[model samples]
Target chain A: MTFQVILVLFALFAITRTSRQYRKRKVSLYWFLLWTGLWALVIGIALYPTTADAIARFVGVERGADLALYLAVVLLAYLVFRLFVRQEETERSITQVVRQIAVQHPSKPDETH
Target chain B: MKTIALIPAYNEESRIAASVRDARSFVDGVVVVDDCSVDRTGEVARAAGAIVLRHVINRGQGAALQTATEYALDALNADALVHFDADGQMVAREIPMMLEPILSGEADVVLGSRFLGRATNMPFTRRMANRLARLFTLAISGIALTDTHNGFRALSRKAARELTVTLDRMAHASQILDLVKVRRLRYVERPVTITYSEETLAKSPSSFRAFGIVKDILKDKFFTRI
Candidate 1:
């Protein structure tokens, strides 16, 4: 999983660099990065022998840590969906506001003759 | 006779030059509000003889028009205001026709209608969407308008000055209908042919987007209504 850790680091680096440009969709992207990092952390932790042994006994599964990771993924998916709805509403309101400005403002004089 | 034509554009550099050239021949003044377009929409329109207002960030069609109308009413001291689209859908000859009702004091506002009678070069899909919107507006406003979202509408300074339009997006058409119904403005629709170009056809909002516009009106009716 060394390759995966490097990939996560690269993603974090890129997101941090371009976060400001994410203005409108920043929150959604932030959540995505957070969830991804969480999964990576969980995976790296589960690879440990002591944690895997403890999880296997706790959940009555051959790999208890895997079950725990699966549950986390499901919960994260639900949370992301809720946040997506909120983002859609925000964008919709922005669209409505912009359209109003278009009709309300008149053009200025551009010619002399 | 002192009127200004308001044209709000975003990335319309290609078509606006021709549109502004057409508008200058008819109106006393032409103002093109560039709503933070990421192009030379301002420079081209200004060079085409239009007063250009640049928004620091992209607002929307309604917001840009709102900016232009306020300037037309306040700074320009216009006697009448024409809400013209930046797209080349309207003709300069129809400006006089739209002006007649307001100029003659027959109506406070005049709407130029393409569906009311014979029109030229109208695409089927765009026509369908407009007709659907017209029907919805008719039901909501209880006004039998054939062209609910006609971009060639004109209003006297008094009427235009009084409207407090707040919708900043495409929902401004519904906002107009609601205001007309609420304020009881002396509004009339006149037949005017609108020409549709390939660019305009491409810009038509998708059916999904149209549904979003309808939902926006409903949201306002529930959340922001009196």
Candidate 2:
């Protein structure tokens, strides 16, 4: 019962944060809705454990916890891939800026050491 | 034609001066892109009569080459550009030979082929590694050539302006081949000698880094829009 209470509280806190981000224009409406829905689903599952069991059984998984773990792993992997792609784009942009600076103000050939 | 030799140098103070001097002999002008070297590479290259372009931060050899190409083509108004290495592995005397195809209007780009001429003092492991890299490049780019990664190359003004090196590292060599094929640029390979010293040999990328190049190329090929 204590664990359920903690999980519900955590989900509520996450929903509140997501709403605040949406209000501050930090997150898009689509993202805010998606996150709020995710937390709401989490709260629902925490409040009613049998819902997870029903969904897990429909998905051919034996345990609700195992289904959550699988989804978390897949989601984390996708996020990691997105971060890697973003990093590469950032590095390319940095190189472009550096190249522009280097080309614009080249050192004169006659400049002595 | 106003041929400018472009040398991409890092922390190569000891060899930059000599490389600049040698390359200066063959081309109308020498431009060295010092990729934020910690040593006195930029000063030495400038002293040796190369128009020095200093990167505020170390981008990489490929990025440096792109910078040099832009400067040579735009600022210097060069008719042709030669890509030379600062490590003294590539022979500066072969600049004209590489430029011949471009000068004669036979090809837009001319690549140096060490396999056709000689890679003197090349270690056995390095030779094997280069051979594997050659095969891998052929597989990826679908353009077969004797040497895929030789730094010695000459490009006409049009080719220099058109072919962009976006990879920004050793993978840029392979990316160049891919561009050559995709752009349908006329390219020819010329025999050029490479004299590898102990320092240059030590500076060569490890076999493990080959995997990184492969990964980068694959990502560029599929994940990114060219």
**Best of the candidates, lDDT:** 2
Candidate 2 C-alpha error for residue B26, in Å = 0.7
Indicate the worst ten consecutive residues by lDDT in candidate 2 chain B. Answer: B198-207
lDDT of each: 0.76, 0.90
Best by DockQ: 2
Native contacts recovered by candidate 1, as a share? 0.27
- Chain A TM-scores in order: 0.43, 0.93
Each prediction's DockQ? 0.14, 0.80
For model 2, how does the per-residue alpha-carbon lDDT over A45-83 read when each residue is reduced to its tens digit? 888888898899999999888888899899899888888
For model 2 chain A, where is the 10-residue window of minimal lDDT?
A104-113
DockQ for candidate 2: 0.80
